[model samples]
Target chain A: MQVTKREFLVATAALALASGMRSAQAATAINYWHHFASQSEMAGLMKIIELFGKSHPGIGVTQESIPNSEYMAKVSSAVVAGGRPDTGMVVAERFADLTAMGALVDISERVKGWKGKANFPENRWTGMSQDGAIYAVPAYAFVDWMYYRKDYFEEAGLAGPPKTFDEFLIACRKLTNPAKGRYAFGMRGGAGAFKYVIDVMEAFGSPIVKDGQAAIDKAAAVEAITFYSNLFVKEKVVPPSAPNDSYRQIMEGFRTGQTAMVWHHTGSLIEISAALKAGEQFSTAPMPAGPKAHIARVAYAGNGIMKDDHVDAAWDWISFWGEKDAAIALLEATGYFPASTAALDDERIKSNPIYQAASQTLDFGRLPNRFVGAAGWSESVVNPSFQSVLTGQLTPEQAVDRMIEGLEAALR
Target chain B: MKSVLHRGPLAKLGDLSETRYWVYLLLFPSLILLLLVVAYPTLYGFVISVREMRLTRPGLNGWVGTKHYVAMLSDRVFWISLKNTAIWVTAAIALEVAMGFVAAVALNRNVPGTKLFGVLILLPYFLPNVVAGHMWALLLDPRLGVINDILVKVRILSSYKAWFADPATAMAATIVVEAWHGFPFFALLFLAGLKGIPEDLYKAAAVDGAGPIRQFRLITVPMLRTVITAAVILRVISLVNSPDLLLVLTGGGPGNATQVLSLYAFQTAYREFNFGYAGALAVVMFVILMVFATLYIRLTRVSKD
Candidate 1:
């Protein structure tokens, strides 16, 4: 059964030729990981993938959706264990942590030469960049806004959504009717509740990071806490479950007519639309102004290359998100605001009355606090401290003091 | 006999297999696998607990002996979590054991419809923690909970209650849900043990006029002691280590009222990227579990041959 040298050489050559042909014909597979688990988000992602595939036949994109709650945990573990995807979705709050962990690749040079670069505003790029290196391409924005029952306001003899906090409180009191099991506000005090707490604190003129340092004005924070928690504690205009209501609970409260208003971002518009009428039963409004300022977070969620193996394809996919077709497709499906200002001119977004609040928000909305440990500090410290005040376990001053101490510890 | 034993290949092979070192030779692969799969990761976790290994902040990554421990000692959240974890584990275990024991006894009677009743009792355990947690969360929801509706309709309450939102009832509510999920483990084990018990003993006790309660206390209790100890230990370890139920139901909240050590450790690790502190919390949990297991086995005399 011994083979001759010439015969073996001939067989080897044939195998090599066959392998080379297969390799040449194979499409380049690039994986994209994201935390878009909703039906509409998945639909939007599928549309984007379909468009990308049609446009680039030689490149294959594999999309993986991780649950938002476990997205960072998976990303970090992947980075440590060396199984990172080619690209990953990045939100503004996680940009710093993701980059610091070396899970994101710097693509400043590519971004600099990108043709769609000008479509996004400078602030969007700022949210996507750190240390003079762009880590992600801004894809969509989550413009924070308040959704209220238009009919409820009308029935309460109110003209429209209040423009300031004092009027907002009055409206809350007027709309609340315990006999009907209706509360004024559905306060998000659970998992994703930290965002509104920070917004309110900032509204009271207590900047979390002032001059690149942790400089929370304790007195202002205390005042903010009192004002926010008083809606539950003193005013009694909030649900008893306010201290534990998260995104789902608060949204459910608003949709089911258990509450008059709920504060959330534009990302929830499609979901709310599915449950109630947009222009009649429910309406969106710019967040009410506080004594010092009006705070609305325009959080940009983007895409960044997580590994270097498929940098070109990764860049292609990320940059595609900014294109008008892709942005409009996503906005139509999920109602996520496009980060590209150019795409904002679409007739659907401009002509729709429901998106007026988002348009108003974009005028003055700012990015969320972007710094290392912001996530941990926000969810772990700020959320619970505020909840403690709401539950009457701690006074407003005590909760603010706790937040300050925890913030200092987190920074250190 | 001498001719047969004259260094044949088969004889020598048999002798080689009989040697004491051959046993170790056969065990080498399994021992290596154990070290790789179990021992290495455990040792790594311990080493991480003693360092400042933040995943995001690589510049701060280095050895920091006992720094995490010292920080944890003064951490107010840690203290609150420790207290909550103690109560959560203890109360949940007691409720689960009591319910499981009762359910097992009822099923062991071998009455009509026992099989269907058994299946119904075990249904909750088949659901994953996340599913069960969500189901209970919706059931006890303040805005639209069927439980509250029924209770109010039945005149048990005047109004709806946010079971998981209020500190007064958060832990208790979570414990009830956990007990429902975990009691089946004990019932399954106990049911098996109950079947293994002889009918003769019960007959003799009954003939002697030792009623059902007295017979269960004297015979069944003594017979099931080993199974009871093992089940309680396993359930306690499980309840203390897994915080998914509380995470979903309360997020350890209405102000950390239900914040268990595991949830705190999880938040510290994933949310904060502070693996050092998380590892320390984990090591503390590991030590507590170890001490409990050891003391429990010793006190129960389950190791006696």
Candidate 2:
């Protein structure tokens, strides 16, 4: 029954350690929904999740993949049903809307302490912040680029990729040979053309939305639509098929050498490079500039944590993914550019020519407008109106007018 | 007392009451299920239609009675979608019926491989609508498609043209895809009706010195009237409600040139996140379909007699 003080202190310390370990192991699981459905990308995501789970042994992460087109609907339904995933992927522009709804947790303080904060580019962080509060973290940034067949450019006697809008048009015309069943360029023109049109408008120096009003009737936007339409209708540099093509169709056309060039994102370049290595020779260049200097519309896709219940766990999951090492690992595995500056400057990324070329454009990139209720601005108004103008169903002026009316109604 | 139990009116009343009670019990589960699954959502949709609901601004959404309805009435896209739906339904029904009747007659013959041909003709109906849309989109693709290549090689057309991209052709392309997928259903139903027709009637027509065309016009057409009516009504309802195929194939585009009401409502609800406005659009679409269905049923019944 006689006890030494040293032995008693050691026993107390051992008891405290045991309780601490037990509590750490009992942490709740956080649900993470993402739009990455590709096998390789999903595999990379799984690795990140595994790393997070290992580092924070108590925090279990449940990841789900929803198709990109249905992601918004699924997220909305989940939020309305009051069972939103603990963390999920969201577009940067819609962060404002989500924040306004109080559906997203502000991670400003948590992010400030994150070791990777200094590694993220100032612009990337700007996208994640609103009114001095950071709502989410940027995981990756994607921008539009002109993907072309290198062999086709050489065959057409072009020295290199077109440097400006006029040169791009000429290249398209020179490469087009209808008799040979080939087209110079391909553009998506249906309900999905808005992405391309938006890029073009940005390149033309048009603001997508200003003060909750439609600016499509502005001169820059009109010029952008006219320029795109001329490629299809006037010069006929693009095939008639451009109007109906989807992203896949356009990518296929460019990959199969059916078209010389297509307006697409950097993620597409990764896939196209693989196809190129398989005997299809292609390269990418920054999207051609309009009357304004070269400008690219950048979009981000990253994970978001719900504000309601799982705040701490969500923050842990986001911080784990946003770390410099984690981002670099993901970028290397998935062929996507990291949004973090340190990851972007990592020797492995800087040495890659495609990544370097893509990163140069990211410096000049800008996010789309963050109007609260303008989610459908691209699909409902921009695409249809652009289609109408390109197909001669409406004149450029009329198309612009229609788009304004539609945007006004949509924003209302 | 035994005679009363065996022959009196009380026993009949008891039997009738028992039969009624059992019938109600038997129907109860299905009735409850229908109310829960169908009726409840419909009622909820109406309630939602009166609210100003935005998916992104969930907390801000609140009751705004008749506002969504008024907005829909003034919405030009709504009008365009309604017009497109009308075109789709009329064209789909007319073409499917004609094609189905011809196909049913051709396959009704006792020729070699007739049964195999009949089954092959019905195969498209078995395919899911999304797959059928994608399949048609591929087949009709102007750039890398087999159809355009063949057409240009054979000098049928001067050059390749985008079938689904141009406004003039987009609606036609949608109509073709819809009709192709729908004709098989009509063919199967009409064939069943054709087989059920008494062969003796046709033989009597032949003996009356009537030629094949005359017999078809008189006996076959008149006899198949009921089946045709039913097929037309079903096709109309389907064509009006199911533009999901067009949504996939053309996405109601190349400029809203192919937008139907169902696709419009979906875009409004899911894409735009204007659930209240979309719910109002859905309500209007439902009413329109109901009116069309009622008229179709009456027309079919009158023709059948």
Candidate 3:
């Protein structure tokens, strides 16, 4: 039980060195949170993460999966509790609110030095920037289109998709058969009816909010709402249930041949492709033009790095994911479209017909205005007025007035 | 003789000598848990209700005092939600209680396959609330639903009807779904009460030439008062707080026709991020529930008297 002073000092030194190594190892571990629940998608994401980890041996990546329904709530709570992950994936629209809250680190300077920054389209880059400060990295873009049953379209004497909104209405009228339990369109006329309203308004060149004020009461906005409402109440081309159908139901309507065409996002392409593999015949077309030129509203999901003690780690991960090569890999693995124009030429990506066709429509992609208080715009203005118009509770004019009132109050 | 002379004051207080300390020790854990779980969150929620808290905000939100309360009071949506809650509570409770009593009575009799029937009656209650909402939604679907299919096939109607798409039908559909899910609770409670009632009371009634309905009105209703009152109170509280089924079934749609108070409060807080206003709305709802609970207790006592 007796030891020399020299031996004791040597052992103490060895223990301190081991503890220092352990702390250094722990420091390199970075946390990433995402809301992808699909098995295939998660596997693909983990593969990308593994590849990144392999390329950078100094940093370790940990993935946390959150359900889509509760993703926002969990992220919000995490930020407020000061336990936010280094990198988090969020919908593009939500980035504004988080940036406003100062929860996200402004990566403008870091992104400027990123090799792939110039390759991304201006629109995609603009989506991640607020007041010239880039707060997020653009990942993928989603655009809505009219998906129709090709066989039904032909049977109704339509040689091809309608090129104009009037022609679309005519085709709908011809395709509707109440006796056979089929409708011309499977419209979701409830709170979510705003999706369609947005499509039509954008097509008609009606600004959702113009000059920092809600311009829904404008003539163009009124016309768009009227056209949408007429499909349910006046034209009778849509079923009554359209008023309450969610995105899922609307898709189901198309799958089950309950409607001739459905307005939805390109995300449906995967489902449609799967259905086609199972012998269902369907095709998609760009939304028809209004009195003006056709305009497609694009919604996207992006990844944002939170401003925390781990800022360097956050930038590293963001650069890893947003790099053109990495973005291309993600696009091939998942059905998501790369936000970078350079990735559009990836042979593996271009080989997919859906991606090819979707790329052609990207030129028409438009995003909603960046209102100062945009978070409340959807629930307060879009949903309420959209519901009112669709349900015949208010005329298109009245709905516009109501939306203005609500939006003005919310903005104030 | 010396030992008897030395008995202490603590010993004289029988049972306190060996167990008093143990009683306090045993209760300590539960007391701490209650304070941590219930009291803490309640106080925290109240604190949050007075401030302009936003999840997206960076720092501590400034206090707005009674501003949130005033805004919530003046908000038309809040008032509309209150009216909807009133309608839902009244309709769901009344229908559930009546149907449950009838089902319980029918099960109490010597009917064929009584056990099977009882199990079947309890099935809907056991279903996950969200799944139940989806199931009913499918059944009520205007174009593809089975109920409309059967109704049309059987010559009951000429055309398909949107049961949940119209404002009038949407409210009715929500009430029906809520009632369907709720009745089993009342039925089970009433069945337990029925079993506990002595057979002698029925025998005495029969001897006195009391008719079945008259006996039910006099004996069964009077005897089952406590159980019935408890069931009603529980159901009312549940209906007031839980509006998820309606949210899923109708999405508070057809132009806010079925937007119940709970759903409004949820959207206000979570969706709108107006936590302060939402808290005020919640406080109002809590007060209403307390008032209702008090009235129910008083009414039950008066009926017994």
Candidate 4:
């Protein structure tokens, strides 16, 4: 057949268009919304994205980064406004709230059948499940621990990091010297103050919500509050700005040698290492135990399938977080403790003596209170109430009463 | 090369533009836009307020008439926020207007540095509330803050004080920062108003042997009454609606000492996931603003002009 130039050009163009459309149709698009904003966190996320792309050639994933403080607000608004991403990042404490708001899909069957699920411990699964249904897969953990100045301890002739609350207070009194413009502890009574308030309460054997009821041991909570606040108010071991010190203030205080100790998590190791030397200058230790119980939080942060339309792709994206390579990459970049047993064995993590505290905490750490309104009650009520005690505006008893009252209102 | 143009749909639209109802049709687009942007949202909020619409508690979502309002009656935070909002808006407005008036009058004198002064005066208005709040927080930091350093060095303070930590000082400190940021808005408006006042009136007053202060009181005051009223009303609305500055500085702490209505509602809605209660709080704010605007306009008698 004799073909004209016009006909041949038209035929080629049509063929190209048809092939492009077919390729586009075959590509499954999945979107993940998360709240990882730090440079290291973003780098880790990018590495995971690159890894995911290489493994799943048929799927295309897009990630949206929201600020951690505004993540829940954005997620809630998105759920109500109805443009939810295919998958979403969920932390242990937020799992209940996210599931309650219908932002997370039940993936019990998919999670149960996956062979790799065996790599995660029972506690890991427990954090991501509610009402006997799975919502997310564990990715990493923020094992609560303490960062202390080893040099300062040696100067004060202290033995080591305190093993009990009483020892901790004595160490603070001995280390604190106002003339040097240094305090013993950087008490975070500001934005994220809620975590420690709850921790102290738990350490004193006060169950925030017992058997799905608002059951707080008033005496224990008051004791916990009194002990925590006395570190600032009565003992003067914390800085004067303790009532207004959030993450930034406290971290700055610790890094600048204004405070000897700061309570954070394994996540801050990379940032802290940049400012101070490990072992020689600073070190990490397990949080000191209370009279009744030892308390630390092994908060497992993970990803959940928010929409079921692309369930297969969503499953791959979430489950990939548990893979050894992905977990190790995240650990290297952000210093996040891996949730998978396989990744925890990496030599890079095991070689660091500073990580010993986190390892110890893993054996005994409790999960944060997981309930529908846990986030709100902790933040708005508990934080301010505790700060009130720190600032001498309220007594420990008054603060405890306010917390119980606020929790009741929140649950209602 | 010349070609014959076909006037198709364009010609039809031109023809339609010349019709008798064209102006009304043109106005219809703007009316629709107003209904969409303004009316729809306000009405939607009103509807949401009367419903049990807690996002986290979706199972309990249903129509519940005034349940949120009834709860608000006993809400201690709500009452505290209401009282705080009144003090915040009133004190802030009074201070902002005074500063703006003084600045506008000084700049109107056409001094050597008036132009530069005007630009410098307007700088605060350019900063977003979030930035201003954070900047002030750092400046007022108890340990490393320059403000504290200066205060202590000059013996104005016994020692470095934690401004935001004390309930007595928290709101006052936030108000000072807010006033600094907002006075520029009034200055800009008042400066424009100052420009429009006829020089001839001042000259006539001078011929009658009136002093600068007298002419200002007699002529400039009455002439700029409308501008003052408008600026004050707009400012009151802006301050009432904005909770960003307070959010950054205090987050309505050290124990709700700096709590205002807008911040309270925001915490309730986003933090507590209690949209119904937040909506009720918002409705109260809306009602308060509406009544204030109405009474303010009547009292000022700006319509008489």
Return the top candidate by DockQ: 1
Give the better candidate number (1 or 3) by lDDT.
1
lDDT of 4: 0.91
The all-Cα superposition gives candidate 2 an RMSD in Å to the true structure of: 8.3
lDDT of candidate 1 over A1-412, digit per residue (tens): 9999999999999999999987775547789999999899999999999998999887888899998989999998898888999988999999988988889899999999999998987898999898889999999999999999999999999999999989999999999998899999998888788898888999999999865578999899888888998998989899988889998999899989999999999999999999999889999999999899999999999999998887888899999998988999899899999999889998889999999999999999989998888998999999899888888899989988888888888787
Candidate 4 interface RMSD, angstroms, 1 decimal: 1.0
Reference-based TM-score, model 1: 0.95
The lDDT of each candidate is: 0.91, 0.79, 0.77, 0.91
Off-target runs (Cα >4 Å) in candidate 2 are A1-30, A50-62, A100-103, A130-132, A213-217, A277-280, A307-314, B1-22, B57-60, B110-115, B302-305
lDDT of 4 by residue, A1-412 (tens): 9999999999999999999998786558899999999999999999999999999988888999998888999999988888989999999888888998989999999998998898898999999999899999999999999999999999999999999999999999998998888999999999999999889898998989977779899999999999999998889999988887899899989999989999999999999999999889999999999999999999999999988888998999999998999999999899999999989988988888888899999999999888889999998899888988887778999999999998887787
State TM-scores per candidate. 0.95, 0.87, 0.87, 0.93
Each candidate: chain B TM-score: 0.94, 0.89, 0.90, 0.93
Report the error of model 4 at residue B95, Å: 2.4
Give me candidate 4's TM-score against the actual structure.
0.93
Whichever of 1 and 2 has more DockQ, that candidate is 1
Candidate 4 chain A worst ten-residue window by lDDT? A22-31
How many residue pairs in model 2 have overlapping backbones? 0
